[model samples]
Target: MPHAVKTFRPALGAGSVLLLVVAYLVVALNARFWGVVFDTTGLAGLHGAKVVAAVAAALFALTLLMLLPLSLRWTFRPGLAVVLLLSAAAAFFIGDYGAVIDRHALASVYATDAREAGEWLSLRMLAFIAAFGALPAALLWWVRIDWRSAPRELWSRLKLSALAFALLAVAAGVAGKDVASLLRNRMELRHIANPFALLAANLSYLDHARDADRPFVRIGTDARRGDVLVPSKRPVVLVLAIGESLRAASLDLNGYTRDTDVDLHPLPIVNFGRVDSCGTNTATSLPCMFSDLGRAAYDDAEAKHRENLVDVIQRAGYEVLWIDNNTGSKGLAARAKELSAAEGADPSRCNADGCHDEVLVDRLKTLLPTIRRDTVIVVHLLGSHGPAYHARYPAGFAVFQPECRTNELQTCSDAQLRNTYDNSVLYTTHVLAEIVSLLGEPSALVNRMPIEALRCRARRGHAGAGACPEPDVSPTAAVDPGIDAAMLFVSDHGESLGENGLYLHGAPYAIAPDEQTHVPMLLWASDRFAARRRLDLDCVRRGADRPLSHDHFFHSVLALADVRTAARKPALDLFAGCAPSR
Candidate 1:
């Protein structure tokens, strides 16, 4: 008889497998954590090694101890696979975009719609996940485990847990004070602690999810339409245009060297130069922007239970409408008339990636002629959101050459990123210009004005028949106005274009750079609206450089529409103290 063929099969003890996984997770999936550690501790000498070694030891022990509970015979491999996959996804964002895996960041992830999330899909991301997540998991599932009896396995796990605890104690004892100080100073490092950060974020999300069925609290219930101080026959209209990812530093109106705001150069829009966002991402900023609770007091869990700005304005008897081209209104429009531009988006303006912001202009065109009441139209734009910046605008809007079209932002050159981003900013301005021109049209106004003749009178400084000039406050320019309409544009948040190795937003708010917080805001009121409201255009211009924030948004819109409520704080309203123009 022929000798039986021998085959080799890899096998390891359960403890050995656990150790291998722990080591791999800490060392392989945590490049950002280690990089921050080395950067903060300075890898120059023995001191660096000491600090790094202590952190490594503590992290290792904590990870092993935490994971030990799930390292049983039936649960070990599956749990490990799950961890690897999650860690891989976290690592990709942390490494490539310099994003943190904190609760707010996780909230942004959870709130992201499929179209927005798909903007992040790329071959590089796929390859990274496959190499770091799926491959290891496949290998882990394939390996054979030398399992002992149940009692012996239980005792072995307990012994391993004990060992991990002892190691953790030793690590804490040796350099606890120094490590604590380091972490306190660099709190962001905590957010990059792989698996731990992910685990903590998920736990926080679950904790908040428990309140999903809680009773919804109502606010501004005393809201009612107040007597118009400067009465007019026509209805009041306020267009609240919430912009997305538009940094103040990138706009020409805010002194950007580029011509990103060229389209708005002729328009009489008040550019608030020193504006700050409440948060670095839309998930955090959107709710805070509309909530009565200011940024300092804004808690996602608490805010979800209360009514927002839209609900209050709607309750005040204004015909509130939310037209969304980005994502949904984040529950702000729960009680308002809502329209989605992306639902039946115009093919000329939309593609597989998403719809252009001009789709908003199209919606406004249809809705403009029909408004016959005091209205608050919220135009939520998908403005300059990345890393698919190139897809935001039309091909004609690609004036900036060599744009970065790929989702892999880090793969692009600095110029390409800025060019693509600037192009988007330009297109946004163009959209704003279009909206302004539309608002100035005779058909859109309640009482028809010779808007074309006015444009002609101001044509010395502008080219097109539709381009508007600066506010004509000349005594001779005064006349009785009919329609009361205005536009307020404020971004949800800002973006980071490879500044200080950060490619996207959603760093912890405390440590977020200016590029992620300093957003652009501007106001453009129709001539009649300004005149009827007795708005001191010059005074408004004088205060344009005031240090403003999202705190002003809620009260300002309310004040503009003459909505009176106990909840409205006059102190936070931007138009609070403007005297009537002479």
Candidate 2:
């Protein structure tokens, strides 16, 4: 019995457990951040040592602050579990999107309906959740902690906190100059701080939502159609297609080496080569582009409350409708007669995965005849939306071979990902071509006019002889008796395809890369519409090379619809100088 004597050691104290947890999070769960640091810093000597020290100090400071709240025995286990779970979730998303989860990204996640969110759910995501979130959560629950009384524990933690703060202050003082410069240069490092980034983003989203929930400030109350346009003319149908995640660089229309936009080459499409988006995500850009307030003066709350492009068009006695194949138009289509392809209304163009952009075109064909008045039809396309780019187009349209088949983009090679994205753009070209054909040939309207009449009008200072009436006629009276059609295509935002190790969209607008900000905008107008309005197609083509941004969208759309409002700024309209006014 005496020989069988055993020895027992005390279990780890609460502070020691907290320290271990913090260390595990910093070193193991945050590999993404450390990798970013290593790649970006490019330091391997004493300067690197300073950075390491500074990072360590910052981590320690954070750990100590977190630990202070867990000092109470009642709060310790639950708090630790929550932190671990959140860190794991953050790690999973960082790996999945190759992006830091910011407030806008958080809002997108929240706004995503269950069916839409399911597109991203797969075996890979399930495994990630199990490994990152469930495993750590189970371990935390399984562990036992040795704790002191609340008073003694609080006192001990206060001392530890002070020491941690002192160390952080000393480290900052020692490397203040270098640390400041590093952070300033590599702003993304702030987003890489695990759990903290997630926490900050959640808080920011909550505050933004709270602020937005207030009654919206109304805008565009004075919206009306200009008297220069005849109300009794054959309906002018304007189709405004809002694309998703379409980068300008990938379009052949913009001189991309690939044939991504070959189908659009024969059409009289004016491709704006240099154009910037209002935001890097659909949720932000969709609303901002439609608002009377341009990007510079745009306020989310005010924009939400106001009548948008569709509303203004409706106000001007035009029938407005929104047909969406993407997620509902981020409240932009709320007031209009809205249709969704995802609602099982058109099963041919949709499936469990989602509907293609062509579904909207199909829907539009059915509705076109019903529209008797001047109308604005907005078609929102899920164009090139990722990481399921391959799913965006039909299988036959996957012209780019060896494309990425999975939504887990990181699982595929960069070449495969790009190919998949390009295939989506290729499909977009077909969609646009189909829409153009549906509008009928612009040449048909040209043949309808008498040659002598056109020549006389042109000789009398009218831009187009056949389309324009005599100088004695009022501008409104000069409306073409035939149907006039116009089509405008623009993306909600651009995408990032493995550029600088970043993928997807939703980076903050201020620091977003060109890959995420530069979007494609194309315009097509029937010969009758162009000639009647005296719009010079050559002038528009020349201006295509000029710099433009989403700031032009609001006024350009209004100008296209001939809507008169105080909010219409002629300087911001791309077609302002091209069109002849009374």
Candidate 3:
């Protein structure tokens, strides 16, 4: 009986389980992070070294993170659960769209309306939540802790923290050169830094929110319409349609070989080929475009409290209305009669995903005849917004075949992705054409002004500057003297369809790629409106190749509405030089 003494080993405690879970996440669940590191570092060629460095760095980072929970013994499990849940969500977005969860992206998530947020919900996300969040959360809840005395627990935490720090320091010292070089050369790697990336982004967003909550500064108080009045018997109706995530390169009118803009080709439209956006995201661009200040001087805090294009138009006695098929007006339509497409969306045009841009068009038909005043209608369209591009348009309009049907765009091939995106653009062309036809007479204004026009305009009065004559018309003159109606379509910003591995918009404007900044600005005017305003369609078309941007939007709209406010910078107006009411 005494021949062999059995050796007993204690089962793992809840603290050990938490540590194991953290280790598993740092190693097994961080594929996206490792992939990003490898791709960005160009370390794929050195496969063995890449794996070794990745594993070592991940373990070191995990050790440092684990110290937080270990230090707070009572909250250890709950903290782990929260971390797991956030990591799962970050993984889902990074995997789905190859998106970097930066501060701008976090802001976009916070700003997303409920309807838009639903587009990202799917079986895949649910499975991810279960595997990465719920299962671990449940395990943390059920596991039993050893529950040592407070003094002992404090000593244990101190020991663990010291150990973690020692290990991290050694690890960092070993791979410091490689890590520093990789991060330095690949700035985007910061966005792919797993849980740390998300934590940093949240902190950045909180800081921004704190700044935004400060008192808003009112701009354009001196805003008043031009003394020159446009007395039209039929009432001037100007439709400024702000398209969403629409890129100029994808449109046929802008030199894309695709038939995305086929429906619009026959119309007398002027497609401004090289127009830039104020920002690469809606939340930034929408307000910036309407503010009296141009992008260079635009401040969100100041812009929020002030009168925008709609406010000035309203003050000048024009009936201003905003019809939205996208997100809310970003506070730009605060003073206007606002309408949402969701209010009247038919089953065919809307679902859980969102209402199509056509819903606004349909509602417009009913509202057009009722308006009896000089009016400005800002139609905000949900045009080609991604990563659910396939859901944007009806099936009939999917001219491109074998489209990518899922929101996980990376799941599809390049052809499938491009085809699906083109389908959305095609749908937008139809929407634009429908609006043009509905208006009966569409006139096109293409801004062909050169970049030098902006630089030279201020110098016109200076010696040796080419004699660019300023408008000689009196303030009391009427610009559009008869029945006037026109539709102007410009994108809030452009989209990036897997360009340089970027799949969506919302990149910060300063460093944004051309794919995200260059947008389409098209104009369609009624024949009567064109004649009444003395606009030369051919001249506007000839100028279509010139450079322009959202800097022109505020002044152009004020000019078009015949508002003579001092806020209107005539030099920035696209129609400024063409149609001065002499």
Candidate 4:
């Protein structure tokens, strides 16, 4: 018979538990912070020692602010467990992804859907959570606490708090100057500090949530169509393709060494080589770019309450449709007919990582022939969203060799990551090419034109002898282009491909790298659309290299559809600079 094994359970007082958790958080969960500290201040001499002491004191002060107060019998273990898990998650994202847990980043996190969030789950992430979060939480739950008399416990806690404050004061006094200098020079350090950054983000979220029931302000209600001629006799159809996380520096059209835009090379696309994005991440940029308020005046908290460009265009008598292939359109499509790519996406183009951008192309192809009015279709593409870049495109589109196939970005080599990212961009270009072909060649569209378009043709007397031809649903059917269309492609923001130790976007706007803010913008319009809008392609091409930003997006899009309003700023319209001579 096996002898019964003796169980060993450790008992710790409330103060001791607090100390253990504080120590774990400061040491184990603060690797990214310590790494930054060492990088900024080496392990030698007086200045380094002063900085290290200051940072250590600051970390202790901040961590103790929460732990010291809650280190009581009823709240101690559960509180520590929450702190451990939260800090562990914060540490993982900060250390692995070089992500900052700030307001904008938290906003993106809140907006991310379950499918996109699943891309972040990996074996390493799970193991990290287990070792640092779950294991400590388990021990905290199992270990017995030695409770003292209420009066004694309160007195002991006060004494401990007094001691901690005294130590903190001493440390601050000794290294206050160095701390100030460090903080002034490296402000991002605060954002990388675990638990504090997370706490700060949550606090900001709470503050923003207070305005959840604020009154909605409608702008551009007085919007109307301008005196733009309709010489083409076909209704205008504009496709606004909002690209996701594509940097201008990586596009062949912008002089990138790789032929990422090879498929779009033959098209008469005006590539704005130097375009600044409103924000480094989608949550900030998507809404900001769509708002009438430019970058400097844009406030995320107040944006939802105000009407955006889409609403104004819709009010201007254009039928609006929003097709999202990525995440939902951040409430921009609330007033429009929104179609998700997943609803009718081709199974051949989908996988565990979700469907490729080709699904959007397929959706657009089917929607092209159905245009019967002045319409604006917004196509939100999942372009080059990381870290599973390898799954973003089809196998044939992965021309770059040796891709990083996993979502664990740190495990991949620089080349592998770049290859995978470039492949996604290439695939995006292919989708754009398919769209351009669909819009440029009217044969594909006119052959399958709806009966409504035929009726319009009959009304215009375009049908021979006033007898409209029955719609030919054949691919080889020859017919005049039935619609005047245009396409504008602009990435929501850019990405950081391991540049300067930053892997992905979401840096604060103040210190965001060029790679994270410089996005690609392209415009392609059919001959009829250009002529009707009085747009000169050659003139637009001459200013292709001019400096531009998302500030121009609102007015430019309005100009595309000739939507005029008191809110529309003519000075901000890029196409107006190339308007045809009267």
Candidate 5:
């Protein structure tokens, strides 16, 4: 008892410091991430304070639970450590910052006064002061015990738990502190692992521990497919070809000297300087971009079903045609033209020209003849799609000089990847141009149209090529009512391409990252489309300085397609008077 009294004071002293440091980092990391605090903003009154309290409550509880086995210091390891880190950040950002700040951007860019300095300064983003100040201090305060003498019962038991917590800190630092992703996984998978599995005599403890989230890809057996067949007014149309992993600053249409959109150079179009994607992947982007969650209001928990823009347009009495080359139906497309919606949706299959974009043109010829005056066909192009650049274009579309000659971008030189990737852009120009000629020709027979036999295509990440050609889009010839077209061209996401030691899409903390989310968006119109819609293409194309979220898609399509429904409305859509007729 005398020995215990002597050691308690210093032991409590260090424990107090440990608790404070943990609390500081937990709050600071998240607040900085959520963009809730500016460098100048004092953190005392932030919403993140509540998060800190909650985390502290949980930590205290965990510590109490851990007191059971502290002699060898076998304290909380996996669950507790992960929870502490995630809770700290999530509460800090979402609770405190709300949606006003871009925490991910600040986390990656703030320290350096180089590239993002000017733009980030506008929001007065200040995560740096929080991170540099909090992280080191917390990290240095590891739990320690100078046990010179003590009762065997208390010493052995509590020491184990203390050692456990220390080992945990080291493990976390090595793992790079990506706590948010781990929490998302928990939210995503609900089943608790069966502990009884450990009873198996030969079972590996590690395997049993990780048996919680199984069958990573759930097979959806009920896939219903059918072609979309609907009627509409004789609508002039514009089909925007979306590019994946494309940077807005790289587009020639955006005045990029790199000539990414080279083929479109001769057409009349204006490139907007600032545009951001609703989500970061084809899965996240396809649905979010065309939904009402343009600004991160997407709620999978509140989500019973995804009502996409195409659905609104079709209901508005416009013929909506969806052509896909990448991720199929991605929940959004599944809603429309599927057997469920079609009065008599076809077999949900179509063929095309060479392995490239000719598939879309070929599909269009059949559907275009059947479309009435007020029809809107969204021709989703397989433009500049990537990875195997060598296989995309036909024999000689290579205009940029020496070629990369191969695909697997990670294995090739950046220049080689750039060469091969740019060549794909060269083909994209030819394909889109041919698409323009075919769609523009009101006089030519659909069967006799030139794009029937077109060929080749390519995306992003550790798996792709990065180079692209921007379209010029100068003044072009008049557009016709029989086949009018407007275009909204954008990329689904951007890629790192081996930059800063990152080279893939779906990077963790991937709620929606700029590199993964920053995409090119161009709004171009044929003469007939501009005049008929009675729109100031310039103002609409300018897309307000106000940040646009992907959720506005439901409203945008409803407004542009002239479709009004109880589910969505004119006042709510993200856009007004978009292209491709819908």
Candidate 6:
């Protein structure tokens, strides 16, 4: 309509172009999803670059077909509308897990109080209809207006290069990823590698998603590049309280006003309010956090190529146990212990399909009695994991009510969703406290050393799952000698709830918000570590920015367990490099 519509409109041409764009973009979307999925799981680019090239060829062909229709129609309205709608829809679906989850199936878990599946589907369906289909269609109505002579002799010139232009769109995506990853790092251009780094990331994400069934990386006890371990005097009990879909800004530690963390408020903890994440998805964020690459080297292919804290701790000779409450995608679970499904060997542990995070602690109670030396245990909670926020907690834990009824966040009011999510935070506080209490018991250590507990979030990194809001989180305060030693806590990454249309983590890195990158970190050390080392808890916590990345988590745990590893580095220890006033 903006062009010569009634006279120039070619129905077949318009439809063809639209369809071509849809098919090509789908390929692009799939690639982006893989970039996210495999970056964490280590399943991307396995079949070789040729396979990726093949995918690129197909997408380009479809794009070329799209041009044929566009050239015939010449209005560009259809192509432009398709691009807008699909881009928006893709973001909505990818960022939102509740959108895809079958809600009725969720309710049916307790069949006596089951709700219809359609109700759940309706939430996403209505949202999609309104935002993608309806809004775009309405825009189409306005598109019917006949505008100025926007199409001039430029149109004729465009026709000659149109084929190259259309194909270039797809090729640019492919070249951006390959060229940047291979050459940019060598040239010290990785930080400045504009659209290329972003494209490569999307391509990797798409490749990973397509290969979800493949095994991530083979976890083992061994040394690789940048590995470290050390000796310590106490048994290590790490209560890794992984927040679900958590956005750092929502935390009280990060300056939000809401009291989302019911029990975390009372504890003396170190608060690293400036940490950030590398990637957004659990698959990527989890493993990348556990890797030795730190923030600078955390990338899709390299994530697969590296060793994590679990492997590092194992090399230090500690008995490694992994207790998971969230999906295995987050790198923490993969670092240690048996999967929830593997608990079948001990019927006393978990009897059903899987065990809760608390079950991991329960398993620890059983295992710790026989441990003669130190040990490291990781507890991965399904804290505030969404759509099924109701499932995040047990029946008694629902202190906050009027919870969001369904996972489709779009359906529920913001307050409802907030309340629902905060309940999970309450659960996190309870679990962390429970974990600390368990660690302090005589059974945990032969010497019965008091354990320290610190709460932390990553400074900043990539985004993936929607982040939780811990609005009432407080910053780091003075560390107390009376407190237990070596309390370390930080988020794996920061999150973006819905700033500037950004819903979750996993956006292209350049465009990712500060929320996605900047995280919260906090710590509380025990008197043993404070006194034996003459450690100044308050001063260290106050001026605590020495680039403490997860690379050190691997080394720090080894030092905590008191086991010496050939790969250990003393500088990796937080207390190692400290000096007076400088």
Q: Tell me the TM-score of each prediction against the true structure.
A: 0.91, 0.88, 0.82, 0.90, 0.51, 0.56
lDDT of 6 by residue, 1-582 (tens): 377645443233333444444553444434433343234322256543533453344445444444444444455666556544545454445545311111111111222112212223445655764675457545553433333243643464355356546655565564546533433332312211212232344454555435445455533344432222223444434444455456667666667655455345555556655556655445556666666566566664545545667776666465666655455534444546655523443444332223334565565566655554445555555555444565556544555556776656666666666666666555555565555444442122111212111212211121221343443434433322222334455555554444543443444444457766665555554555455445566766665665555556545544444445455567665545442211
**Model 4: which residue pairs collide?**
none
Q: Which residue pairs show collisions in model 1?
A: none
**Candidates' C-alpha lDDT:** 0.82, 0.76, 0.73, 0.82, 0.44, 0.47
CA error at residue 364 for candidate 1, angstroms: 0.6
Q: Model 2: which ten-residue window has the lowest total lDDT?
A: 457-466
lDDT of 1 by residue, 1-582 (tens): 999997666999998889899999999999989988888845468866777788999889878877898888778899999989888988999999898898888888889899999999999999999999999999889899999899988888888888888877776787777788889988998888998888888898778767787888899999887765333458777889999999999887776766677667667888889888999889899999999999999889888999999988888887889999988898889878888988776788998889999999888888877877778899999989899999998886676667898888888899899889988987787788777766762323211224333234323322233445544333233232334788999998899998988877998888999999999889998777877677777788898898999888888888877778999998888887783211
- Give me candidate 1's TM-score against the actual structure: 0.91
- Judged by lDDT relative to the true structure, which candidate is superior, 1 or 3? 1
Please identify model 3 stretches exceeding 4 Å from their true place.
Answer: 1-22, 41-71, 155-181, 211-213, 227-229, 296-302, 442-483, 508-512
Error of 3 at 132 (Å): 2.9
TM-score of 6: 0.56
List model 3 lDDT by residue over 1-582, tens digit each: 578875553445544665676676666556766776656534555654754564455454554564365436666777777878878887777666566767767767877988789777778888987888789778767666676778876676666567667766665676656676766666665676667778787887666556556665554566554444466568778899999999989886766765577567557888789899998888888888988889999765567766788887787778888999888898788767898877956888886688887898888777777767778888998999888999898876665667899887767898888888888987787788777766664321111223233223323232355655543333232233333678889998988888777778876565578989999999988877777677777877887788899999888887766677677887788876677632
Superposed on all Cα atoms, model 4 deviates from the true structure by an RMSD in Å of: 9.1
Q: Once model 6 is optimally superposed onto the true structure by TM-score, how far is the C-alpha of residue 517 displaced, in angstroms? A: 2.6
Candidate 2 per-residue lDDT over residues 1-582, each given as its tens digit:
468765554467788777777777777777777777777645579888777778777866775675577656787778877777777777876766767767878867877776668878778878876887678767666666777787877777878788788878877888877767777777776776786677778887776666555665555668787755555556788889889899999886676766677557557788899999998888778888988777888766567667777777777788888888887878887877888855655666766678888887777667776667888888888898887898898876766667899888879998899889988987787788778767765322222334333234322221232344533322222334356788999998999998977898987777789989999999999887776566788988888888999989988888777777777888888987777533
